[model samples]
Target: MTQQSLVSRRLSSRATRTFALVSVLFVTPFIATSSANAQVYTRAFGYASTEPGAFPTDGVLNDPATEDGALPARLRRTTVALTTTEAPGTIIIDTGNTALYYVLGGGRAIRYGVGVGREGFTWSGVQTISHKAEWPDWHPPAQMIKRQPYLPRFMAGGPGNPLGARAMYLGASEYRIHGTNDPSTIGKFVSSGCIRLTNEDVTDLFNRVNVGTKVVVLPKNGPHIAARELGPAAAEISVRPGLTPARPAVVTQRAGRQAMNIPVSSAQY
Candidate 1:
């Protein structure tokens, strides 16, 4: 070959090699990201049934509110004097007030505004925290998916996941005390049945509590109203008038408190 032809051929070969290198560099990251997502799915849900294309490329499944404009000041987290016979470290969910109290003993508790179950979805009972997880994955229950077919069957946990920063599973039940992506949902009756707190509040609660923590969910129309009527000292009083007053019941001390007769509501996400 002529010298000029040899130079041209050598340049073409170099260009081809550079193009191959660039292709590998670009494609490798995409592949690694996909693999990492798959692994997360497997670890979270114990199965990788859904295809990668089914997930949002941005890693957020829902359109979360950019700001907490709807949140009310009263619903924000604060420490307050609470009068409850229940021991410290217990969680008291006053559904009527849309509030959660982490009993701190000595007439004090850390209170947080929360989103409780909507009208027909309210429940009352005592349950222990069976499990706890951070950035928990979501598998919308069958009933929820039936109601809202547009919801993803499974969503990997992140800022976009409805379960938010942390989750404390209440007993073996589907209900949980968890964080919410939408801060506006706090202090509202929006969930199907689960209790929701702002991500920051939930994270703080999560750090303070642990697995097997006692959770007392007062009825939707229960103690909080009576507390409002009688004062903070009446918080532990059961709403059922005929029943004798007693301490808020725990799993181990059911006989001490009047059993909540409210019907259990349906499970939520």
Candidate 2:
């Protein structure tokens, strides 16, 4: 064949190869997306108001603010006096204060900072812990695909599992009190649904509470008030700047020689 003809044929072959590669690259992701949509992720957000959480989806335990906007990782080794009373083994979460209390009894509570559901998710209710687990595996539910189909279908419990160190299943519903890899999220609101705790805190709680323990979650706004009128949780003890991790604790005291002082109180003592 003439050299010119040979050159032309090679160019044609290159063009054909390039076209085939381009076609595959363009079509591959769509096919993959179709398959991904068929899988599950978390049950947190629940159905489209019509669907129930069945698998494939769902943490933070309570905060009124979005986690992204709030500073993370400030609460540590802090305990607050509670006005409400719970059984020694019960778990009480105050959404307004963004704190979770593992009622240690008499007066003191094992207080831990927490992150609640931000915005539309603020809610209040009283329920019991029907069950519990460690390093729990996660299975996404069907409804999740309606939002992000590309999410993983199943994830084992461990460092990577969003479920964290422990899980306390709630009601017949898909809600859970679970751990999170993002400890910074502990004091902020984030997550589609379900209460999230720091991995360390969850592990600590898992070792303490048993099945059938009571769980009380407060609401963000009104009308849908929490089931129990547990009283003011921060009445006796207070933190200022206030509950924000960004704030400093401002403890006030009154009374005689037995008065409480800043960062100190009698209720939890």
Candidate 3:
């Protein structure tokens, strides 16, 4: 073959190879996305929502401020060691470390990143998930309203509202384990007194938790030996009921002195 013709053919072949590689690169993500959608990673605590593309679009739960944001992998939901005798379905909040654990028995728990109270606003105590709500309405308590007059007196549940997707009210003290519109606040010390999880994380915990789920909040500066030692957990287990247990004396007094009387609200935006 003429050298010119040979050169042209070689160039064409190289171009074709390049095109094929580019094509695969372009299509791979879509294929992976399809597979991901089909086989969503089920979260612990029986979270019904799937991962990857599962952000809600409803006005109440989809906060535009955090639409594109993501929680750090460390803060995202994962099963980890939680060596507690607490029965499965119990909720434990490690406020100092910004982690929440949903005990699943068998020495495992689902840990989620959380935002806790700032300084004097912090509190610790045993509380029950007295109530659960999806897209719950927000009523700025008299105290919160006085602090932020610009905040609406009563905002119906929606995307921008402080409460993101789910709420697990903490007994009669007005604290709650709730989702936040501002996901950036996760893993920080910035709430009034309630524990804040990302919308997705809280929704997962909400699905598995019941009204009477015991919530133990470790005090700021309290020892979180188990939560700190946790690594990834293996195998899936169903939530089972066991003995209703006593409070660990180790976690009792962390928030005892600082437990404030703040009324329940969405979260501090």
Candidate 4:
């Protein structure tokens, strides 16, 4: 994330302008709360006092539109199949199930579908938001530029920019949780590697998180299949059993199954 934009830390003039001159009685109060959107994006996953954030990176991506579909809808309503309580405003990106979670206080979690890196770009790590931006102009990294010279140096924030609406810059790395123009690709194994969230969903999450939030990616926390749905694939694996995480709706790299195959052998019972 670039140095703090003047608009950051406080509500943007646009937001004020949008709500200004309102005739409603509760208008003033609403504006006060609206400042939250102006603040930087942070991760507050109910941790003690504080700890150093992981996956920190720098550099800005295009400003993504804050339209909608960015929040973790299902995660907001997930039921804990087993024990363990998720903290308030906690974020869980389950790549296995293509879901993102927004911990809402109680033991429940809001799960939203997500698109992750294809088989090769897959990885797991912890990090916090070191920067936040809205309508941020995007400049493809040197590598992306070299690969595609036709790419523009900077793309202003808008619907077309690859960096959809909102972006949370991870600690100090090139990684980020940002929105995308291609909504269809979401909830699938795609992208260079960064976690892709719906434009609407990212916007919602942007406002909820802060500049120092924690992000923990599990083995297969965001797969499309629930524990029950895994029956078919689980049985298909002829090697060893699949990775049996204590959680559900997760599909990870199983010990027995190969990446090229989708667990469809019938030699073993």
Which digits, one per residue and each the tens of the lDDT, describe model 1 over residues 49-154? 2443432322221222222234565666666777889999999999989989888787777777898887777888899998888777677665665666544655
Which residue runs does candidate 2 get wrong by more than 4 Å? 1-74, 222-269
Per-residue lDDT over 1-269 for candidate 4, one digit per residue giving the tens place of the 0 to 100 score: 44467657455776776676564556767766554422211111110111122111111212222222233344222333212354565566677777766554444444555777666555666667778877454655555446455445555555555566668876655666777655655667765456777665566567778887777666654333232111221122222221111111111222221111111121110
Order of the predicted models by TM-score, top scorer first: 3, 1, 2, 4
| The 10-residue segment with the lowest total lDDT in model 2 | 259-268
Model 3 weakest 10-residue run by lDDT: 246-255
- lDDT for model 2 comes to 0.55
Per-candidate local distance difference test:
0.66, 0.55, 0.64, 0.50
**Candidate 4 similarity to native, TM-score:** 0.52
With a 3 Å backbone cut-off (N, CA, C), the pairs that clash in candidate 3 are 59-159, 60-158, 60-159
TM-score of each: 0.60, 0.55, 0.62, 0.52
Best by the TM-score measure: 3
Cand. 1 TM to true fold: 0.60
All models, RMSD in angstroms: 13.9, 16.5, 14.9, 21.1
At residue 136, give the lDDT of candidate 1: 77
Q: Estimate the TM-score for candidate 3.
A: 0.62
